[model samples]
Target: MTGDPLAPRAAPLHALPPLPPECPLPMPVQALGRGRIANPPRPTTPPNMAWRRFGVIGGVVLLTLVATYQMWWLLRGDGIDVLEGLLLVLFVALFAWIVQAFVGAIAGFVLLLQRRPLRMGMHADGPLPALSTSTALLVPIYNEDPARLMAGVQAMHESLDATGQLARFDVFVLSDSRRPEIQAAEAEAFVALRGRLGANARVHYRLRQDNHERKAGNIADWVRRWGGAWPQFLILDADSVMSGETLVRLAAAMERHEDVALIQTLPVIVNGNTLFARMQQFAGRVYGPVIAYGVAWWHGAESNYWGHNAMVRTRAFAGCAGLPELRGVKPFAGTVLSHDFVEAALMRRGGWALHMIPGLGGSYEEGPPSLTDMLVRDRRWCQGNLQHGAVLPARGLHWVSRWHLMIGIGHYFTAPMWAMLMIVGVSIPLLHAGFSWGHFSLEGFTPTAWWREQDGDRFIAVFVATMFMLLSPKLMGWLATVSDPAMRRGCGGALRVFVGMLLETLLAALMAPVTMWVQSRGVAEVLAGKDSGWEAQRRDDGVLPLRELVRLYGGLTLAGVVAAVAAWMVSPALLAWMSPVVLGLLLSIPIVALGASPAAGRWLRTRGIFLTPEECAPPPVLVRATELRSPGTNGN
Candidate 1:
């Protein structure tokens, strides 16, 4: 009789047989020479690449200098208080962050304009190379809908079969679900899927009794039990979908590059039906490429892995990416929530090359359906990223790896920092009542005389510069889209794309205040030692109820009102300046509710507004994924 597949086995990782010679697996130190695998030689950055890096750095420096000069000039009054000084420092820090993104946007603009290939560490010069080794495709699922999960898996499996290279790959559904009902549903779905595909199908499913380290542990368990069976593995999230050709290419790339540990493809947002989701989908499809290419250009060998939709060398991952329980209690300690970045860092530390290929397509994932859902996800990410503060100073880590960690941390920290900056700015006028209003007049402004006032002219210049830096990236993304005829047509032509951009920008601005408050609260909660426990993502949660919306954003709206009133109490001019923030906050409930409406999204789709290339001409894999109905009632 056949034993239960879910039962744990005694198979140790070391007991697995060695890979064939053609696979070129990286051997452990004991198998090679001494108990130490020599560090692989690092690739030298090309002269042009070095210059690009320098150009980015130079641009940031120039912008930061201009901002700093303006800030200093603004605070040059005789009666400048401690609050004003603190505001200046915060402004500098915040402005520097803005400048960094602006510079990167410029780099992205240049790269897209050149239309050069973005394959950084790829070896093939002509046609795609043939894949020589086998790869295991892993989907580590939590308490997700069984039918939905199986549908995606089935679509991918069928796509791979269509490529005629299905023998080279095996698909595994590694479940970490704790609910009995969910587990039963998953088992039934798996059985039905396998039954339909026949016995020759390589699709397999396993449910772990003990979900030790969550997703990371789920993957690690596979590595210990079956990772040795394959030369490489592609990690995928529950919502992730990739085409057969893309999968074959990724496998071929890994097979050709022996030193490379990981290759991350750009996963475009797809299947978003809500207004918020559709906006995100459009922005991701349009602007994501430019930003991704810019980052890939700089992060050649030390690139990061984004957990899902990426392939990794099995041996490299097994040998180097075994995560240790960080020394702490909860949240900032214990199992790392954001394991992808740390895994990449560990792999790079072991001298394995990591790269992100932005030029490659066919990878797709879903976006959050609502603002509330997005914030929930962001809170967990905030904790995970902040936890990387401990890993940043680890011995033997490359500088680039540390930079990745810092960038992750900075992403969340910027929210709180901006909140603090706004708070300080509002209080400055109230604290120093002696400040003159004569120079702060909005009418008939004289630049030369206003500059002599030490605050008004400089503050206006700084505000304009800040806005420019903030919006320039979107403009670059727009330029990149319109410049390409195919892309332009795919996004509903120039006029529609332009209109869509304007709408997206307006919605983004409205949402910014709400997001800022949510994130700031998240940061505060983390600081207060609160842990963001793992929860299943609500992928198909359409529009939320009005009461729920009010509950989520009522406090934000109140805060905005209070802030606006406080600003008005300080000065009418300050109140006018703070109108955007105030309006966004006061209108938070309706904004969120309307944005979460699927009807609005459908209306936009009908009008061909915010149309993406993938939506216009759906890829076969995506079409299949959507067309295949869920096998069970669990889909809803």
Candidate 2:
């Protein structure tokens, strides 16, 4: 019936060769020897980008300084006791984090208001351009649900075929699944996907026996074996889906900008069926753009890369992004966990431009379905980001690259810092009550605000300013949303959008202490040399049994109760001051359970609450993926 099963079919399939067993390309592991890359190529940096960088950094520094001064004035009344000094240090560190985010969000708000199309010779809207070079869509999976994996692949392939760029691209399902049953299921899914797409489809699957370094290693194996065949490659997480138009645009952008090694797209979280997931989806949709745009605008050619939904120049990646095993024991040593950030940093160090286009739509991924799931994932990420402390010192990395690494590290560290701040805050009052140190006074602490009174007024002003900085970013996102007619309509009108924002904010406040505790625990574990081994993420409804929820969050509730009682015994004013943290900790279990509830999610959706554009009016690719993943449709 056939001369060779691996032979290409007539017409469409003939444009690209069948997957080869061995097409060797040298992908030497990059050396960390302390030196800059000799005569590295010059990347084309964005013009006037210095001003943008200065604006973001300057704004952050100025605001942080002002907040620091205010805190100092408020605490300087009694000559700054030991407890007060510790409190001030924590306050300043935490306030700096807040200020940095606020400044970035403000920049994003301005960028969104301008609505200027980002240029690197790539336009988000317009007729699609034809791609000249081949691109391999690399989907790396490990013990994941095969049906969901194949569903995304089929969706993207079908979408790409619609754009007539299918011939220029190939799909590779790279698996690191260790379970024999899961491995077999993956093969079956690949076969089923191929059958559905017909013989002309250029989809292939490979299951590696040795899953060295995990996902990063799987991609590298592909690069060494078959990377020479393609000029570009786009990495997709198991749940990633991108519209055909976006894929073509990314490839064409790479073609146009040869010096650019990577381009990261803003992936909107979709298909969240749990309340927790929905909250995450809504926040990401509403506030994500401004935050992303602000970073992208200022970052320019030195932007960071997320792990997936990004296109990369194969040669640049092979040459510059080769990762070496860190020489250490367990968690902080060996294979890089958060490879995307490190890869981008390395590529940029080699003088290749890395950019993120947050304005470019059509990229999507799903969120962890529950708070528990989120915490588990965050633990692994926490370790990975903390490991970046090692890479930060690598020679020749741009200051911005170092900043990105620090930001990643800080993302985890701040959790502990916030938790410590609350702890210190609670302890201060507890100590005063326990040791009989007498009542505190705010007599001479006046740093007069333009329209405030002396003592307590200064305290009120400082507190208000801190809260304002914390909440202003959300307000900016809400403003941006209401201003856009299409977005507003998609998010269930300006009223529902505002309602959704408020609900999300309230829920977040209640969840804040719980999150802080979990992250603090994660940081502590990683620091204590515990490794977060690879585990497949839960994709279905995340509702857990009441007992399970209790087991997970009981300690937090007990802590909250003790803190509340202690504060109450001390003074009612102290209790009031600590209520937010105490309340959140007290309700941790219910807050997490509510987040994991699919019933609650659906109930809210019925009322147009927590709506995102993807849910309201999905792109065709997402719509197709849903159809293919229906119970009877997928080959499973």
Candidate 3:
């Protein structure tokens, strides 16, 4: 068995070798102490970044003020009632979130049009830079597919070797898997990977007996054992893949900038094989850039980490980025679930600069193959983000860092807020016992006479304005895409790109209510102290059995039907107003089922609808990964 490389391996291949001896590098659990580190190291930030921040924040506030005033006037004809007051409150809160994104997209659109680097001193367009210091590529995974995981690593290994920088970097696969058979497969896969790469391969594998903090704990374990050997390390998700050139430039940037602690690259979604995945891939490919550029422009050196596709200074991370056990119960207590935001905050608190570079290409990852699969992942994310509430008030966090944490928390709350708004809006007609606004003439009641006279035009105006703020990002992203000849061609021309955007928008509208309902439930559960335990993600065409789909979405469909009947009974106008949300809920089962159909995805791809640039012309690294990703291929 030892002599022949092709010989079949036994059960020992299911388990990793004895744990490696510790090369201890102290990573003390940081206290959520008061105030920024005393005498924090001040790193240089981009010029005019403060102005950029002012412009973005100022724009959001101004737009919100104007919108809120109009809404107040619309409902103030007879003074706001309780339900009206609640509606107005939700509108302002949700509208502010929309306006912030709109303003940021505008900033990103301008930056993209300028065709300049997003971050200062970052050169992404020229020759690949050479690396002087050694870097480690750390991929932390748990209970993921062995074949797919090893294939991506092999592809990255080959890409780096082609860059002549293979000697300057090492790859580490840190596993937190608990199953004996799965661990065996992981070990066998790695053994095969090393054999295929020959004797000089620098890849290493380690398994943790304890899974304390899940992914965060796995990485901390690595930092304690071997982090001192490398000056910088790149964190990669199991699905993450980057070009050799992008990896080299990231390392070179760290070497050139001594004070910078981390650099984040925007990982574009690729390899989408289902309709839902394709929609996500197209959106991220077409619209994601502008958003990233906008955030990075204002975020400056105080940027955030997305957990992966980011390189961090080993010393800085070891010295300042240790995560503390959040003091709380169940969901919020124990290990911080959303560790990335807190880690970035702590690093920033220690005065280490963190930056996001979006223009530099080559970073890529896959999207959830279907909505059902996506929601499973989102459930965990929802819990993780909700847990950040406990971290938001930690002493000395930069205000921007606090904003980032708040954004994460709000991401989940907005769902319930949305659902509540719809529920309350529909409940108004029912509360009156009929559609007659003239039913009540008491003081502190809605002004039915005034509403009857001016409601049509005012309603139209508010609706139009809200839709504009919500959908302008898609328009801006499309315009930016079509303007670039190469991108336009890659996306199957300008007309197809336009059509794709419309199709994606329609599907998104149909799916939004379902998402809101599910996320609303998820938020409630998290608040009620429910934990989203770890589960392997579905990475393929997510088609499910009809029974399963019904089991998942039956209640939502029933709720939609009941809501529609109630709205139609009250007034056709109310039904019309609630159609978008009701229709989505009513059709949740079919919509989800269709979204998981590989055939539906293929049909769209064949028609040139929802075609992303990556689909039209995949990069070399992605092409290689696909070539090696099959089960029996690449010695797996």
Candidate 4:
């Protein structure tokens, strides 16, 4: 059958009518036709990616050898028995658990306790006064769709206009692009964005010619330019999206809490177009409430700001978070790159509170679209968080707070240790036959907790561990979400949302191993002094190649074998305990590969599984707006 010319054969897909004139997409920064990238030329050097691979392989090999050697050391012990060796493993595991539990519990309790002080949702009491002072909103951009960035800025500006709140808040575009083309394009895009919302005169854009400390320097430049005027600043990432109403509330909350130098909203993930993104978005929606609630209850004033979706008292950050240059440093030290935690600690040191509001609304952020993207991001973050080690022991500071920072540093370090520990830990039983107890001397000391070593029903224990580690707070939060009368009224009903959350949680579980493994490898590599280098993440989600996947996660294949053999030959209890880590390692490449693969994604979608949040719009917010259509809701 011939196609109708006007109806069907009218236009090619690429030449088809655009998504909408009102919602125009910016040109992707990647090169399309030829050598001409819409933005700038990428570094031809591949940014030490090979070094990263070599370092990771070397480090993993070294780690395995170290773990094997330690196990050997235990076996060769001249005077020790198997019982003592078992006791040692159990002791370390228990200690780690206790330390984790203690830290998590404190965070959860802090989140639960603060309701009134950490105000959220709409404030009908009238828009809070914009301080006579000025503050800038910094949105840092690398290689992203300029269209989406403009859209976000426009949305925020629209929200502000709706509430007449732009006067108090100034928005700034802080570009960290190296390519001259990107810089020029950003300038042009800035003009287009400004044209869309000229009333947002407070909105400003500046591109840094030299991105010294990456994002940290981007903000520092602003502080230097307009520091004398604005007393506070709000930092947002390229993906961070906040409602105008919420922004005002943040400014107001900052005003109300004299001690609060920074206020962070646990960003609600939004716009998950790809399955990976959607899964993350759904998970955050479903399981995030309780975990965030519990965390907020415990953290109280000690809540840390996660860089973006947060507001900061500028003067305090400048004075305290002034990143000191590292001494004798090439890989680990130079400039303070991850300044969020340090900045929070610095604010606290200056006697200012940094708090997280669990109930903040319309505050959104996006996640990486692929596993490779995530691991690449993790390399940078691991280094930054690990860099906290360089500052934790500074003079005349609260050791307890420093403990939190150090613990965070430990969090990244533990990935490799945990992976190795589980493998060696499970293999100990089989290795018992090889023991002579004479080659190495034993420094036998009783552990703080000893029951973990004794063989027990570990399958059930691991199931509990999985849920607790991944989904406890999510479930708890869902169960307890509608307890507040105001929130109950605000969200319309809890049941549907709760159901949405349950589905979100299950999907999150499947995705967790993928995230953990990637992060684990990233942390391990960064710890071994591997740099991720300067490459802009592709903003648009795209397909992943199998060859690339194998290259990225091939090493973890050994984990599956180790786990299977250990399960069959060694203790069932040990296997059960180590299964997730081991099996996770085993499936590492597959997970990374599948996560990155468009073909795999298509199959998943074809089977109707793990739908992402961006693919589906969020459930409409239950807002109680009087006068069916307020002037604020009217169009331009």
Candidate 5:
């Protein structure tokens, strides 16, 4: 068939339209022709990846072995009773977990020192190429406050519009809200947002009748329906916000690198008003980078995804990341709660690359306002992570992917293990005091003089070593910030940063026992077949009342007192060692109440304590985001 003379010539399949002035062509794009584009070669596994893996594993194993030996030496001939044996096993497991983290931190420090970009072959100095494909920006909402959600959406939309590349992207609010009132409010907000942006605005909203699998199913539905229209999609949480430049750069990077299936940007915590939130914000800004970079350095093409604040190729996601209903019932089976890691694993299992870029900036999210809020979230996460046991045996997963799943599972398990270790430690002395309780007693005990002679010093040494391993990552993070002049200044200089670190450490120590108990309870509950049902997170909740605090922690305080008295009866030295934990639990009510106080956070901010770079020198996008307010809506 002959074409009409007036017909416009069709654009070549590989050809991309001319980019705006802001979107500079990178080296990779410079090589592409109008009709033909060169696809970059797939990333190869680093030559030293095997050695790095071995080094991390060997380091953890060596430290564990040495620690175990010391522990054995300390406990030897103390009549190796059943309680003692259980204690040793728990201690070894906990020690190994901490050692693995220590090794990972050391590796991250070395990588940071090298000053290499986390994006393997991508250069840091070059300009990013313009995007050649359409992208959909998806914000999934549950029963969140419509005003807050719309505010974030409006800010992001405006930011993208300012980039002049807004035409290449569309915004969608995928609501899974169950409340009729919340749904009506969401609809009003969406309409207001669209009207404000004019008819040319690309923002759209959809509410699902049934949130089948929750967030995962919500996104899967989007993928099945509208996903085919776009080549890539960026996922955002209700509290998430990304700069226009960052979004465009992410798109450009995806365009340049065909082998990568997903890229997760490190989302810095911001907008914290409560003391608990401020502490988290400070830690995330100052120390989170080192840890993230370290993981990224070794993770390379197999890094895990964090659900939101990330970009994924729609085709790869649709084909590979369709999650299966887990084998059994509620808690351990059914729908996966923590779906990010598993989705990344499935993507990698299909031979697609998953990566993290810790160095990239302008991605932000909010933290839970109070400790109670955090625990509530943690309870759900704990159940989801425990469910990963079923996914661990899935065939065709990469070794690194399996390691990621195992690490996640191990995170929750550590809490219960630590709790068990403490119980055993306290009980050992009770057993020594000739207190025969049930099956555990010091009957017919054989004493090794050598072990008894050196036990105190050896025990002290093990204690010091464990403390070092636990604290080393924080130290490394502080060192990383101090090494950079700009970062140091942004964080209120060296002295202030050091003081802040000290305070943070003390507060963390005080909070550890409380978290331990809470997580342990969560694990127990999950194991008891009680599912953490999908509930809206309490993001903006205020400081809890003193009465409610007491009500929540009264049992814990009572247990702490009893335990303290029991330890004192055992010996003053044991009491001293257990004091930190006991005291923390005893003071749980006050600690939680004070920590959630916005006034206290403001006081700290005024004193230049726990101040983050983002707080000190706010980014323009962040400023804009904070300024955007949601319109009011009446309940249906």
Candidate 6:
């Protein structure tokens, strides 16, 4: 796990990085990733793996047959034709899934179709309204690789300086870290950066004497202290960075649009040294465009605020941004840890526009370098987002806006529901054998008349329902994003976008059930009062061990096994749809793990088939200079 000051402190982080004072200038760029391979003869999904996946389907089919026979026997014994009775359960589940898919997909499509907002910037013509106004850029940090953290922040500072916009912005380093040692390190680092930045960068540093709501409290304290004097502010995480130009543009946009309370940019992911990070970077680069673009279209004035990589009008945020503590304890109550969503809502409620500026560039963030790290992060986010769900119902917000708020909350909920689908899928056959039709049991009791009316025909309805339930959301996201050019950047082209999306979907499909299982377990543990313990994620820096991969993806593999076993016991056809999930889980670790070696990254890049985002192009100086050695790391 990455360093967590608040944890038991298994690894005590130094107040400063372990790097010796004279330790070389720039760290050598980490090992290059598997270069993306473009249209490299759509490779086969390995035949040996097929058998295991097929085994799941074969089980589902076998169960369906047994189920069919049992239904026939029961109905005949009851002296009734059983065809309709057998198909009813399958039909109902199918109908529910299809309806949900269609509605969900269409909503997503509409969201995607609204991607034209990016063009608004092109017409603004000339330099951004020259702003005399001053704003503060806030970078909140904990236990991160201070060197890398400094590098990222410095890069942004330099970019701003490079653009002659240095005078317009001042930067602050806010730390909530508890370990006295790391604090000592950060203080030293601040001194170094301050001297290096000089007057061009008015860098300031502060460690919270009291760490209350983690991040939000950190920001609130800043606001209470000096926000009253500033008109605008930019918030960033330890690993986040933005181009000076983008910062200036955002500041200008905020200045011009009096109604706009917040202007969030779609940040590209960078510093993906591990194979896992590489793949994530590639995926975000390729497929993320469409999603971001599509989302911007429908979002219009109602954009989501992804806490960091965004600029907020200071007066607006401070006045309207007070986050309410949730009503209970632990997970559900206390400070709204995930206060970004709520802040956006409150801004909108204040009649301020919270819009995403798709045209902006140079905004970037980093991903956890491994699956374990990713899940660790997700668990915390899940708790924060779930807490949002509790108050959304009666929050006096617009239905569209409220629904948007709920999506964050709903994300964790979906995992558990998905797990239930697996259990329910297993039971469908047993229900068929006894009841003829798939009907609800009333209070765990079926009326005698309902039982007697059973007649069985189970195959067709199950097939239709399965198809509808699975296909809806993808089709919607696809249709929504493909039409927008901004969104189109994520994919190679229109055709490429569709193909890539499907490929990604195929990958996600296989992974979904597995993730659901992992997430469900995480959610359950959390609900049962398990503390995730605020662990920081580890970065891969290009070399990853297979052992770590297996350990990380182990649960997913187990889920596949569990699914295969269930299908073999119940219904083979059921396994076919479930196959994607199984295959994904089984391959999860490897696909991510093995993909990051210098050898693989080189190979992928050779083919122009990659997973990194388009806008995340490595810095020009970094790209052009190889002798500089390393791209230093940050402490998060």
Instruction: Please write out the lDDT profile of model 2 over residues 154-192, one tens digit for every residue.
Output: 888888888888999988989999987787677766766
Query: In model 2, what is the error at residue 563, expressed in angstroms?
Result: 1.8
After TM-score superposition, the amount by which residue 374's alpha carbon in candidate 3 deviates from its true location, in angstroms, is 0.7
Across 419-491, the per-residue lDDT of candidate 5 in tens digits comes to 8887777666655656654543333332222224547688778889999999999999899888888788888
Q: What is the lDDT of residue 334 in candidate 5?
A: 80
Among all windows of 10 consecutive residues in model 5, the one with the lowest summed lDDT is: 24-33
Query: What TM-score against the true fold does each predicted structure earn?
Result: 0.89, 0.93, 0.94, 0.71, 0.88, 0.71
lDDT of 6 by residue, 340-365 (tens): 88778766666666777654666777
Candidate 6 steric clashes: 67
Q: State residue 152's C-alpha deviation in candidate 5, in Å.
A: 1.1
| Superposed Cα deviation of residue 107, candidate 1 (Å) | 1.6
Give per-residue lDDT, candidate 6, residue 499: 59
Q: What lDDT is reached at residue 311 by model 6?
A: 84
Clash pairs for candidate 5: none
- Which residue ranges in model 5 land beyond 4 Å of their true spot? 1-41, 44-47, 118-128, 436-453, 630-636
**Span of 10 residues, lowest total lDDT, candidate 2:** 442-451
Worst 10 residues of 4 by lDDT: 30-39
**Candidate 1 local lDDT, 1-636, one digit each (tens):** 789999634333233233222323333311111123236665523347557767777788888888888777777766557877888888888888888888777777888889876464453233555677899999999999977888899889988888888989999899999987787778777776776677557887787889988998898888878877798999889999998888988898787677889999989999999999999999997888778877877777888889999999998898887787776656787888898998998888888888888778889999999888999999999999999987876777877788899999999988888888877765564334444444333332222233345566666787788999888888889999999998999999988888898999999999999999989999889988899998999997657777888888899889888977765655566667778889999999999998889999999999999999999999998988887753433322
Clashing pairs in 1: none
Q: How much is the lDDT of residue 319 in candidate 3?
A: 88
Which 10 successive residues of model 6 have the least lDDT summed? Answer: 23-32
